[model samples]
Target: MHQILLIRHGEAAKSPTDADPGLTPLGQRQAETLADDLDRQFPGGEGVRLVSSPKTRARQTAIPVAGRWQARVDEQHNVIEIPSPEGMPLAERGQWIRTLLKSRWDTLSPAQGNWREDITDYLLQLASTRDEGRFHTTLVFCHFMVINSVVAAIRNDLQVVQFYPDYASQTHLAIDDGKLHLVQLGQETNIGSLIQ
Candidate 1:
């Protein structure tokens, strides 16, 4: 079984002006909490592999957990940030994201550039290594769209779902014989689902 864990970046600066924003103070706390939780949930001897998106926020979130797990993060392009909208006023960034999300551009054909080829290439690499039995667990630090893209790819559907995981929230899944399975979502508070 290819056990995969999906972790969203922590709370980021709420600025539409900056091309890429870092995590907020609260976000840092969230990452720390996540790290502690991981330490409790899975000890260092579990043979887990940790990876993160190349974005600053995502990478930051992965650091603490990776350190605890004694795992160096392998960046996956498939787990990068979502595609941003075209030129828009900075003040409208939040609202514009809501608008775009409502439309749900779920699956993009490889021919149309809707999907980044680099991400796909990396994903193929991941698939190829699924059965090697090198590790029992894997963590992926990624953004909302990238997470949703993984879901879309796993389900083989195009209907997009808007997912807003709290800062440093996690969603767990597993892959076996080239199939993805949802384990738990961090959004469920009683069960630590929406771990914001």
Candidate 2:
């Protein structure tokens, strides 16, 4: 069985106009704490693969973990954030995302559906190809929607939003016999009116 850990990036320095934002001070601290916790759980990072979305926040979150494990992070565009509609202003993205949360996967536009499929396909490919006689764990540092997409696909749920994952939370999954199974959902936080 191959293990997959989907980690959400820490709190970002969200800005209305900024298309890409990095982590805040607290978020950086959170990333360090996460690195320590993960290092203790998987000593020396043996048989571990580090992956991160190309997005700034996700890359930032993976840095400390990479340092702790002495591993390089492979940046993947397939694991990046869900795409907003064309011509949508950056400031209006949050509202669009809020609306998307209320919808179902089958109801998504073609582009969105394609994005979801790509994420699942990429993960399945990773899970299928593993070292012989060794159990490998892949650490995917990604965005909220990316994690939600995987969880929803495994559970066979049609909802666009499965559950709210807290910053730096890790959701566990296992791939056995060409099937993906959810071991556990990540920590959740109730941030009323704050969607980031």
Candidate 3:
């Protein structure tokens, strides 16, 4: 089985001014701890691949783990935070996201539904293995919504807010027979500030 670890990026600076804010000081420490944990599990980073969202915080979070594993982080566009409406300010993004999470995916507007499908399909595509003999794992550093959406897809649950993934949390999945199965859900708590 190929393991997929959905890791949430560490806490980010919630600033309306900065469009893509980097991790906060505390977040840096969290990333280092996460790296240490990963190294302990897969010493020397053997049999592990690192992937990250194309966002400042997610990239930052992936750095130490990639460095330890001697692998580069493959940045993925689809693993990014859910997009807000055009011209939606950072401060107001949280409210919009909160509203979106309240409704089920089937009840969402066409565009929103398409966005969900795009993310789900991209993840399933990644959870693949052409070699049957080799077993490997991929660690994905991404945002809260990104993790939640994938978990929701695996469970076939329509509710977008399947669970809240805290910073550095890892959701474990196993891919076998061309299907992604949830092995574990990440540590979660209702965190405020949706733009994270």
Per-residue lDDT value at 161 in model 2: 86
Segments of candidate 2 deviating more than 4 angstroms: 133-135
Q: List the residue pairs that clash in candidate 2.
A: none
lDDT (tens digit, per residue) of candidate 1 on 125-189: 55455447677777778776666666655666565543555566678777666656677765622
Give per-residue CA lDDT, model 3, range 26-116, as digits (tens). Answer: 8899999999999999898877778889999999999888877778888988788777776777778767877887877777667666666
TM-score for each model? 0.78, 0.95, 0.90
How does residue 61 of candidate 2 score in lDDT? 94
lDDT per model vs. reference = 0.66, 0.88, 0.82
- Where model 1 places Cα greater than 4 Å from the true spot, the runs are 85-93, 106-113, 116-124, 127-131, 188-196
Best by lDDT: 2
Compute the lDDT of residue 167 as modeled in candidate 2: 94
Candidates in descending TM-score order: 2, 3, 1
* Order of quality (lDDT): 2, 3, 1
- Between which residue pairs do clashes occur in model 3? none
Candidate RMSDs in Å, in order, are 4.2, 1.5, 2.0
Q: Can you give the lDDT of residue 50 in candidate 2?
A: 91
